[model samples]
Target chain A: MNGGLRHILLALLLLTGLNPAHAAEPIKIGSFLSVTGPASFLGDPELKTLQMVVDEVNARGGVLGRPVQLIHYDTGGNASDALRYVKRLIRRDRVDLIVGGTTTGDTLAVIPEVEREGVPLISLAGAIEIIEPVKKWVFKVAHTDRMAAAKIYEDLNRRGLTRVALITGDGGFDKSGREQLRQLAPEYGIQIVADESYGNRDTDITTQLTKIRASDAQALINFGFGQAPAIVTRNVAQLGIDLPLYQSHGVASQTFIDLAGPAAEGVRLPAAALVVAEQLPDDDPQKPVLLSYKNRYEAQHGPVSTFGGHAYDGIMIALAAVERAGGTDKAKVRDEIEKTQSFVGTSGIFNMTPEDHMGLSLDAFKMVEVREGVWTLVENAD
Target chain B: MLEQLFQFLVTGITVGSLYALVGLGFALIYNASDVVNFAQGEFVMLGAMTAISLVAVGFPLPLAAVAAILITIGVGLALERFAIEPSLGASVVTTIIITIGAAIFLRGVALLIWGKDFHALPAFSGDAPIHLGGATLLPQSLWVMGATVLLVVLVRAFLNKTLLGKALLACSVNRAAAQLVGINVRVMLRLAYGLSAGLGAIAGILIAPITFSSYEAGIMLGLKGFCAAIIGGMGNPMGAVAGGLLLGVLEALGAGLISSGYKDAITFLFVLMVLFFEPTGLFGHKSADRV
Candidate 1:
């Protein structure tokens, strides 16, 4: 009877042991993006890029020979929605890592949960505050608002335009850009002559444009994204203000020009090279990567924007760390991500260190002007 | 300072005219049926989007504008027949809720048809700013003001001079008496909806060149128009025009003289002050309670 009991215990152990060897577990990568709602323009393309890259990576025998499984949720451009999904992804889905947060508000909302859960999160938002205090487990991929303001200021300095008028929306991204532009103006030898703001629901801004027209500002700087920027362009033309208009990197897509019509001509903005990939010089390091991304994206989905490029950099960087760590262990993956250096991406060359989690500088931007409704590289403007 | 004042005045009148047109739409429907049609603003959206789509498909601008107005009338009539007619004898709150649902349904349909992008129509004339004493005016502003004046005159003539118009007004004053007097009060309600929708379409086409139109543009415009109707006193057409202009001018002047951040706040504050001083509204009549 004792021999029979020992054999039964051995059989149970064998059954459990054989289950592990039958199939290799897949590495799970979860994300929450603003796939619909007001910010869908940013998130829709991002979702497409993530799907494409994940498919390509898995086809090549994903990180450490384990297939990649992507779990995605749509945030619908709301902060509370992002938080709820992040919790589910951490607890229920049991994902190895997370890559998401298309907008700044969504990204900032998920940071606390991400830190407490001990999951490595690579964000795609443009807010500097996300990385400034540097939580141990959080990192970002998009060019920050500070970098955008610095890039615009550099171009303004080059053009010798000192007096600037600032117009911004009340959204978080616009607020951050406005703050950075105000703080960094004096250091760049720029003087703000007029500062104006408008609400998101406003139908007309002729009053604000009239004030800007009355100012001694030599250049008008608009720091808002979406349909509002188009209204500003139209208002500028309607008010007959002939000062040079400089937009922040927020209006970096063709939709802005399409809405503004002929009024978009001569408007300049600092944007990522992906906007004018075909116009880049041969020796530029980002040329090949931008072309490949642009071609692949446009082939699958009609056109590509810089917003999608942020997601590309995010997923690629996260996967690179996974490969470098040689496994899906969370602690080892976090360390490998911190040690990432000289990684070329569509946005810019990412050289991450413990001190600088963003790993991108002002050099990521290229000054481009809208010429006849298309982006034209402003030669030698840098 | 004078230049700033002139600039503010031009912008105020331009925007005020748009509000007036939308308010007129509210006033007409309120006069015929005791029910307030909350879907009035969606009429404007449909008008503008339909015209834009028609123009894109190679119709002449004038032809497209006319087509848009006709199509909007049909939609308004259909809304009355399907959504409003079935709820006859319902309470006021129920009718209002039904109209709100209609507005949401229209907005959703527009989203599926047009997608989520702001569309623009080229100005009827050149886009040159007319310089006047250091303040410039967009030609579209002139178009808006002119259209409002024309609409107000036509509506006034229709209400005061024509027998059919008088019959519609009779229905508003006493529906049971109008029906007893052979005025066909139900027909008057349908006519009122048709006219209000036509007015809304004209307003949409006129303002689309300036403000641009998207699927979500109607809600704020609808709310503001409702506020104007209240400020001018409900069921009064000319009062709606005055209320709309006052609201627009107040908003523009507040933005220019005080703070743009408080533009919306100032407008609502004025509305509240009016409600406190004159609960019936600036031009509202003092009617006895029915009960």
Candidate 2:
């Protein structure tokens, strides 16, 4: 072969090896989470986690030898906002990979962009349906509503609680939670006595709780995240109902404890163990991951909240996949993430496989009961 | 069915009480100065935050509430003297723009001063639920309904029995004529703003316990108040009260009977229908002015 042909072949090999996706001056990673609006409670943490991952990676010398630059957009809890911001990040800002959004609806809203552009979107929110209907280049790092419901049912069965009364909010998120819980409750041999709902922003849940109080249900299942759950927690306490109150995964919020005040005690909920991260034993894998993230988070944003911790997990995993892929090749990174096993996540150890994007099982979570305005692990020594 | 109706009533009355309070401010300012203080919701936000902070700082509830009301009054009077007075007799639209600007400005200040998190508040009476005749309610709801009614009644008496209130009414009706009769119309307008803002503060504190107080809380409270006034009839206090209550009930019924997702849509649709069919509103009287 001629010398010129040899040189051309050598340069081509180098181009393929370098992975141009990560070589574009600065490897740009873009994300959209609700930094403002109703879902900010969830978005703020995910944004922080995204910030944490980027900072950590860049500090160690950027992903693929290019300094990692993160592009963040605030979706403001609006689906349109998610769509608009993602479009802006892709079309206007020209980011490499996107890795945010904290609700099923938000991730769903950005699915079109993820499809059209063939860019990987590692969503922090999970409705399960976001990827199930038609998965192109989307993956979730959080448990699905159905999965969470099944876990709750499993927990209830273990406790031998049979009758439940559901009081959820009237919103997309709450409605989804209610449906999933309802479908899964019968499987665990639990009967729902009464189901009631209030607006997402409704502060006063006395009437709803009163109905539940009068019902024959042994326990009340308050669904939905954000202010409504907190209101329910306080209302249940104030109304003086003695029935064991079981909250959906929605109560992982530290804001719930604050809003419920002393009323929060005795309310139990199933959550990924970050809420109990402080109580986890030293040398536990979950402890190191959660503590390191918490310390970094408190330094950057001040204090640690589990609601935000969920977001931190989503971003950390996505960045890891991007690093493994050595570039922003959407399909290659997604494949790498699918093969991720024993990857320590903020919520728990995530082990993704071909069948599941969210690899953590029910055992990965612990039931947390509110005590003294903080979530404590339920005293089930097992 | 009775239980359902009763529950809806409770929700409506609780929410409506807030609207009535805001509507009272609009009615007072409109009747006294022929202008709507668009920043009326800011007064509600200010009152709630001020009282909650004071209560948090170990101030007695009564003292904190009084301080909030007085501070709101001062704010109203100061706003009239400095901001609204300059635009006096300007086009109604111009005045509205000024109020909108003020509302946005006040919201910015609130976010800066109070931060964005919702603060917890204890109900005036501890959270023990009160059951009456097969219906259960929060004691705070009772206080809200009672406070709203009392304030409306007191405002009526003030307009009828007090010299200042009469002068304010006279000024709103005929500014030139009232001034010719040696009434200080500007001071009356200032008093109207003060009373309007003060009532908003009262509503804010009452509702704060029920709904956690936050920076952007008042804007929605104020918009609903505007709707309440429109429903009751502008320039009518009794109409405002009735309108606020009516709107709240409608919203509750819509939420319970229809789709909660479309609850807001139902309320706004009704407002549009009312505006289309009854421009002057049910209780509001028509007023004619020469150009």
Model 1 chain A weakest lDDT span, ten residues long: A15-24
Model 1 CA lDDT for position B264:
87
Candidate 1 off by > 4 Å: A1-26, A55-67, B170-186, B288-291
Best lDDT among the predictions, by candidate number: 1
Per candidate, native contacts kept equal 0.67, 0.20
**What is the C-alpha lDDT profile of model 1 across B1-291, one tens digit per residue?**
888888998888878888988888998888777677899999999999999999999999999999999999999999988988888767889999999999999999998888777788888997887888877778888898888888888887888799998888787677788899999876888899899999888889988988788887788778888888889988778888889999999988999999988888999999999889988779876655311
Whole-model lDDT, model 1 = 0.87
| Model 2, span A122-147: residue lDDT tens | 78885878767547577777767777
- How big is the positional error of residue A36 in model 1, measured in Å on the Cα after superposition? 3.4
- Candidate 1: how many backbone clashes? 0
User: What are the runs in model 2 whose C-alpha is more than 4 Å off?
Assistant: A1-13, A16-24, A238-240, A329-331, A379-382, B1-12, B57-60, B74-83, B175-186, B247-278, B288-291
